[model samples]
Target: MSLFNKALASIGIGSAQVDTKLEKDKVTPGGEIRGVVHIKGGNTEQKVDEIYLGLNTTYLKESNDRKINVPVVIDRFRLNEPFTIGPGETKEIPFSFVLPLDVPISIGRTKIWVSTALDIKNAVDPSDKDYLHVIPNRLMDAVLNGVEDLGFRLREADCEQAPYRLRKRLPFIQEFEFVPVMGSFRGRLDELELVFFQVSENETEIYMQVDRRARGLGGFLSEALEMDESNIRFTVTSSDIPGLRQKLETIINKYS
Candidate 1:
């Protein structure tokens, strides 16, 4: 009976299982996440080689003129070393890690999650998944608020394949699209696309694409020539929040 149970366990019929419980489901970028991994042994003894946790998200990729969803791993953490788990044994491992400052916030179709895996020698690995909500950090929040203060409301937000110049550790970037309702940019601009880059604890860089509304014959011609849009890059610090609107307005005016 014991031999049969061990054989069944090796084939994952009654093997160990893993579950990850996060302290909280919502977190901000650059914040620390605390969690615990629970492992429950089953049927027979198991030799666990290691345990790992990974941060994963999906991004859009273009292939053959079509966009397809592709999985990307943002980061990974090892939670344990080799260990033995007797039948019916249970263990809990505590864990903590810092999220990347540039991680995409969980908005629109963008999703982020933590995955835990238990590696068992000569047996199937057991795994668990827990989704997380990533919000903007203080600096990013301020910048977003500044944009809102300028009368731009978030129209759409999504992660898509990045251009060569914007590629970093990941092949895709998150874009926030906004449209002006009532502000200095209302009449002249059609929409604005914003992308954050090189985000850190102290500072971050921004890329803006200003799309101008066609006004007259000249404007229509410019639009037809694909010249009605302008791209700008700027850097901002936490202190800049006080005058963020003014700085952003000035930059927009330069292109207008």
Candidate 2:
């Protein structure tokens, strides 16, 4: 009977199961995430080799002139060591980690989740998944507010395949698109795209692409050739928020 149960467990008929419970489902970048992993033993004794938790998100990749969604593991953590569980036994492990500062917010088509896996030697492993909603950090929030203060409204936001020059640890980047509704450059600019490069508690680096409104035949030609856009790189600190609108205005004027 024991041999039969072990065989069944090995084949996943009655293998151990795993479930993760998070303290909170919503968090901000550079924040801590706390969770617990619950494991229940199967019908027979099993030797658990290790347990792992991974942060997962999707990114776009171009292939054959088509965009394909690909899964990326941003970070991972090993939670436990080898252990033994008897039939019907249960165990719980608590975990906590700080999310990366540049993690993209959960907006639009972008999604982020945590996955937990139980590894059993020569047996089927069970796993659990928990999704999370990531919000902007303080610095990022300030920057966004500054943009709004400059009379630009957020038009769209999404995570897409990063350009070569901007590629870092991840293969994708989050873009915040905005258009001036009632600003000095409202009539001169078509749209503005902002991408955060590095974000910290005190400072952040930003990349701005300013699209100028087309004028005549030359302007139309430049637009078709991607020459109508100008890219600018700048860094700002917490103290810069107060004058951010004016600073951005000056930058846009230069490009316009």
Candidate with maximal TM-score = 1
Where model 2 places Cα greater than 4 Å from the true spot, the runs are none
lDDT of 2 by residue, 8-119 (tens): 9988888899999999989988889998999899999999899999998998889899999989888999998899988999999999999988788898788999999988
RMSD (Cα, Å) of candidate 1?
Answer: 1.4
Candidate 2's displacement at residue 157, Å, is 1.9
Q: What is the Cα-based lDDT of residue 98 in candidate 1?
A: 94
Question: Best candidate per lDDT, number?
Answer: 1
Task: For candidate 1, list the clashing residue pairs, or say none.
Answer: none
- Give candidate 1's TM-score: 0.95
Model 1 / residue 53 / CA error / Å:
0.5
